[model samples]
Target: MQETVRVALDAMGGDNAPGELVKGAVDAVNAKENIQVILVGKEDAIKAELSKHTYPKDRIEIRSASEVITTEEAPVTAIRRKKDSSIVVAQTMVKKGEADAFVSAGSTGAILVGGQLVVGRIRGVERPPLATLIPTTKGVSLLVDSGANVDARASHMVQFAKMGSIYMEHVIGIKKPRVAIVNVGVEEEKGSALVKETFPLLKECSDIHFTGSIEAREIPHGGADVIVAEGFSGNVILKLYEGLGSALIGEIKKGMMSTFRSKMGALLVKPALKETLKTFDATEYGGAPMLGLNGLVVKTHGNASAKEVKNTIFQCVTFKEQKINEKIKACFIKKEENE
Candidate 1:
């Protein structure tokens, strides 16, 4: 028998739980040739969802869990208490090497805490940042520490740059990614005390294509290939980017239907407009991966559809095949020695 990519999914974790989650697992299995899904949730709930469509029994299986982890629960306490919760169960599979990866749309806090506590980090990985790929005017830029690593040290930001560059190059297929530290000014002297200290470090490093600082205003113009920041700023940037893109698309849509002349113009430009705006839609890039962990872990939106979930699964295949974590450590350690 050939080795297969087995993913343990937390079926009860997402906003659309068991329904979209289970549906997504089935979709991933259907789309990928050698992938098996072990859905962790109430067996009956999974069965009910599966009954809605015909699926290959061997490809999709459900593991029963009695309790669900709500967002309200304290993450550490919840992971400790809800031993049978879908999130914990899914993480455990990765720890045991039974599954190749784990995907969750559950509590972001719980998932971040669980990934480190359960899956553990790679050797010498101090802070594993949540890295997401963002499309820029030039192309896609990998934004590191997009959710985790708040109140970061200068060292963490440095690591984020190195890891982000490795991910963009190996997994996302960007070569010589221009790594930039997000700042209020493009100059090294500008930014918070943290950014100012880290600016010089990134610039002095040879492993990454460390460009100067990138202000938020310049992100849309394809200013940088990888934007490195602490989680606080990166999260704000990520949310704003998503919001701005959605708002722009919404205005375009409403405008298209406003008048007969506008309607005809919309019809003429529909295909090109869609192709252009598709670049801005975050879902097209798949979920953000919690990089530097011992095993592959991706955090999708709580309301992710089957398409997003499916793309994330395929991303795992490439992340693993590319040996992204190993490459990151090598790049970082080499940079460290050079420093």
Candidate 2:
């Protein structure tokens, strides 16, 4: 039998807290036999929501957390003050090994701050970066440091490339994933000071399949399997990618409904169109995993629906079953020995 992957879910963290979050936990437990969900939040609210669903009683449990951290609060301050907050409690579970992973659709700052301060980072990991899979024409690309370290150094980025390559090759099953730095142009010298400094390091790095620089325009075309960038640049690329995708989809839907002739055409193409569009849906990929953490900590969109939440939980299971952390540890250990 497969080992159970226990996930500590922050039930009071997102916009649809206790409702969609609870439903997601129920859906996850019902869908997989090797999964168990420990809902962390206000007991009364969580229980009320869980009561609406039918699930394996043994697969779901609730851990009461009296507080909820908000986006406006300073992450460090909130984490320190809100000792009983859902985010803090869930992360603690991971730190204590009570849960295999922690999942939250809460404040990004709180999650990032608490992940480091609470769950801690793997040794030899200079900095833990948020890594997420973004949809691409070739399938999906891993974007490292998506929003964690806004101000980073060349060494941090080089490590990002290595970790990103490892995740893509293992979890995503992409062999020898191509690694590239986000740049202003394809030329090696065309980039900011940081990129110029980091470029040569990645090129000389033997661990990853370095493919030189990749421009932002080439991203959607699946230019590289692993796109490495500092937190600031990666976050900008991700937000713009999400916004543009939404706008284009909206325009297409509007155009389809504008006229009777187009509406009839839509009926003929709806199935195929939907399948193609599903490939680009960010929710289908799940939450961003904060790579290099001692224990897994995933941060999903604050507005995530039940479907996205369920998918994120599944993503955590894959991360565990693949022994991603162990592989990452081995890579770092080898690097340390060489040094």
Q: Best by lDDT, which number?
A: 2
Best by TM-score: 2
Q: What local lDDT score does residue 334 receive in model 2, on the 0 to 100 scale?
A: 96
Pairs with backbone N, CA or C atoms under 3 Å apart (clashes), candidate 2 = none
Clashes of each: 0, 0
lDDT of 1: 0.85
lDDT of 1 at 200: 86
Look at candidate 2 and tell me the lDDT of residue 109: 96
**Whole-model Cα lDDT per candidate?**
0.85, 0.94
Which ranges in model 2 have alpha carbons more than 4 Å from their true place? none
Residue-level lDDT tens digits of model 2 in 1-339: 999999999998879997999999899988999999999999999999999999999999999999999999999999999999999999999999999999999999999999999999898999899998999998999999898999999999998999999889988899999999999999866899999999999988989999999999999999999999999999999999999999999999999999999999999999999999999988888899999988999999889999999999998899999999999999999999999
